[model samples]
Target: MDLHYTDAQNAFRQEVRTWLAGNVPAKRLPSFDTEEGFEAHRAWERKLKEGNWGMVTWPKEYGGRGCDLIEWLIFEEEYFAANAPGRVSQNGIFLLGPTLMEYGTDAQKARYLPAMASGDEIWAQAWSEPGAGSDMAAIRTKAVREGDTYVINGQKIWSSRAVFADWCFGLFRTDPDSARHKGLSMILLPLNSPGVTIRPIAQLDGDPGFAEIFFDDVRVPSENLLGPEHGGWGVAMATAGFERGLMLRSPARFQRTAEKLLALYRENEDTASPATRAAVTQAWMDAQAYCYSTYMTASKLMNGGAVGPETSCNKVFWSELDRAMHRAALSLSGAAAELDAPWLDGYMFSLAGPIYAGANEIQRNIVAERVLGMPRG
Candidate 1:
């Protein structure tokens, strides 16, 4: 892979940099978990839509600039460098948007993509249930078909952004007798539908970063079914690949964190222990390694390679790298780490890295069985 960007790519970077410098908020926005913060972030999304920077890789008709993955990486790099507001519509634009493009029909794409890109509809992920956390095949949520609709009944816990999201996409058991990974369908439903209840689940920061959703015979049109009925396991897995792989956790995010960690080390270099210094160096190197690896993956994807079990390796690396970077930052900060809001909050959030987007343990299992061709224990 070429280490240097083409002239056009450099120009694109400058364009993004200029726009962000002019439009990014002068002050950081609040967390999107709160009502005020949520709307603030929504407004930010709308602003991005107006600039046609919402989802750069999407087609123009879907409110995007029609760029490729490499360009998308450039946008992310600039986005983090600008310190822009967190994307409140990440569930829709990053995870579901790609899934819809692949699995959705023309009509489905026409109906959802534009709205998702414009932030007219924010989406939540409703995959984890009380019984099925990492073991998604253990899902008990039922969606019984009746004429033109599917009657949904079950509960999903730890649903990210459900508290303020407009819609959700999840896998439900379509076949009553089906067990494990079989007989499932990915379904999209509005959060405001009758019999849909959302109870906020507060994080350690006392914000509703996630929620528990209860569906009591909620009826949704059969058109809301994402892919082929009873073939949703594959559709859901594609979305998980996005979550665990490239889109959700961009390499630029960790790069920025690593940059901050290095700066923190330099500030206290005189007092920093040898282990602390070593950790900081390791974090920076890991961040660069992730960035380069993602570039290679992107190039392969552009060349028609697909995201596969190898994404599990990417997931494990970036997630653990995020945690390690934060830990090093805290070590550098010493007692002040508790009072340092950014590092403190980041450290707390990093703790969830291994748990969400399919637990690191589950990801390792995928790597062993699927990528490494190891037999199941």
Candidate 2:
């Protein structure tokens, strides 16, 4: 693998770096889980839209620069390196947007893509449930079609950004007689619609980053369904590929965190243990490995190759790396760790990384069965 960047890619990298240096906020915005923070992040998204950097890999007609996957990777490097505020619209830009590009009707794309790009409609993912968080094939949420409308009735839990989001996309059992991943429909729902209720669930940070959403006869136009009705498993898988593949957990994020952890150790080496130092070095190396692997994946994707189940491996590796890196930081904090240290908060969040994207145990099984051709017992 020729891992070298071409002159053009290098130019794109410089462009991204220069723009981020000039535009990233001097002070970080508030956490996007709060009401005030939601609006602040929206404003920031608009700022990115104004600069045509909202989602660079998107087609130019959709308010992006039409950059390729490599350029997109470069953009991510600059984005995290600058310590920019977290993306409040990532669900829209990273997950749902790609699915729409692949399966949405032209009318659906025209209606939602631009608004999503501008952060006029921040999106939440309503994929998990109390009973089916890891086993999404067992989702029980139902949406029944009547004439031109679909009435939804069920519940979704662990919905990221549901508290302050304008829209959500999820799978519903459109054909109740069907079982497992079959007979489901991917539907986009307006959060403020009647019969819809959102209850935010507080995280360790005491912020409602996730929510439990209930739908009671919640109705939307049947036109909102993505892909074919009862044929949504394909669409859902494509979206999951994007989520587990690269967009949600880019290498740049871990690299930035690893760098910050090292800086903390350097400033207090007298207080740091040799084991902590070794762990820090390991974390940095792991992050670099992720970046290189992602680079290879991007290259393959750019060349028209498909992403497959192997992405589960990437998810497990990065999530564990995240936990180890944060744990080391908290260890260094010592007594200060109890006083609301930043590392403490990060450590708490990292604990969920293994669980949120698909429990690491499930991922290991997938790697065993699908990637290694192991048989399920």
Candidate 3:
């Protein structure tokens, strides 16, 4: 409940702020604004690696700084506040790396972790399909075992970053006869494997960030299976926990965005009306609430409390707030909204926030049933 930062924590933030001041490149600030912007992000990630700031919470054996969760949050806050480019290896660093740390073999960690930290390999999530947009348990991509390898055959649509990624991490149907969530298996597939085809899908931002991956008898080693084969639903749940919570957009991270949104509003208030001011104030308040919620979550983790289904609440809140803030920004732009106003692209990109990671509607259902103890649909 106590949200105060210790003197040491304050010192850590100052250290991170100083490092970012010297290291973050000004021109690369907008690289996170589009799919193409990842190229600049990759270069910036290299700069972070040189300082051992890549995935600071990982074990030191895997090239991380072995820092605490609070330290990592401080670093994230300052990193975003500096307007540094997004991490080019986000899929690898945030999603896959944590999944591997929890469920992967030692060999798997050794093979991928260092390379991921150094930006030598990029990964994408292969989830969501034409038919399984929100009901991820309904994904139909099948992986049939044959001798020493699994022959994966099916289509995965909306696979973010897959168009240019070198690897894919996702769940597949290892046992087609099993119904619902059973028989699912989390697997890894190299993009260069034979019979795999990738088709990029354009977004509102005019970037091919999402892709459709068609696996036609693609062969992958059975060793790529994460955890127990049929127990992948549990593994995937753990993965989703990270996706929505600290692993993706940490609380300190959102605070940084809130700071920028405040600055933007203050600078342009001369053109904003009373209604705009009210909306901007609401956005700022919501962002502050997000920070408080994240702090509670962090305290729970630090105290060895498990992050359960409740993390979905944070995901729904922040993702929607992000969309709202961007929408307000676009409205403030008036006729310039469509003219590549920096905030316009932000507005367009925010539209995808509720849809990706897991739609807000789906998250509400989860909170109702699990958190609120309500009846199911």
**Number of the predicted model whose TM-score against the real structure is largest:** 1
Give the CA lDDT, 0 to 100, for residue 62 in model 2: 80
| Model 1 quality (TM-score) | 0.99
lDDT of 3 at 161: 80
Q: Candidates 1 and 2: which is better by lDDT?
A: 1
Residue 116 miss distance in model 3 (angstroms):
1.6
Residue 56 of model 1: what lDDT? 95
Clash count, one per candidate: 0, 0, 0
Put down candidate 2 lDDT per residue, 128-216, tens digits, no spaces.
Answer: 88899778999999999899999999999999999999999999999989999899999998999999999999988999999999999
RMSD score of candidate 1 (Å): 0.9
What ranking emerges by TM-score with the best candidate at the front? Answer: 1, 2, 3
lDDT of each: 0.93, 0.91, 0.83
Candidate 3 colliding pairs: none
Per-residue alpha-carbon lDDT of candidate 1 for residues 1-377, written as tens digits (9 for 90 to 100):
57898998999999999999999999889899999999999998988998899999999988889998999999999999888988999999999999999999999999999888888899999999998998889999999999999999999999999999999999999999999999999999999999999999999889999999999999999999999999999999999988887899899999999998888899999999999989998999999999998999899999999888989999899889999989888888878887948889998999999999899999999999999999997
Tell me the deviation in Å of residue 141 in model 2: 1.3
**What is every candidate's alpha-carbon RMSD to the true fold?**
0.9, 1.1, 1.8
Candidate 2 TM-score over all chains jointly: 0.98
Candidate 2: give the clashing pairs.
Answer: none
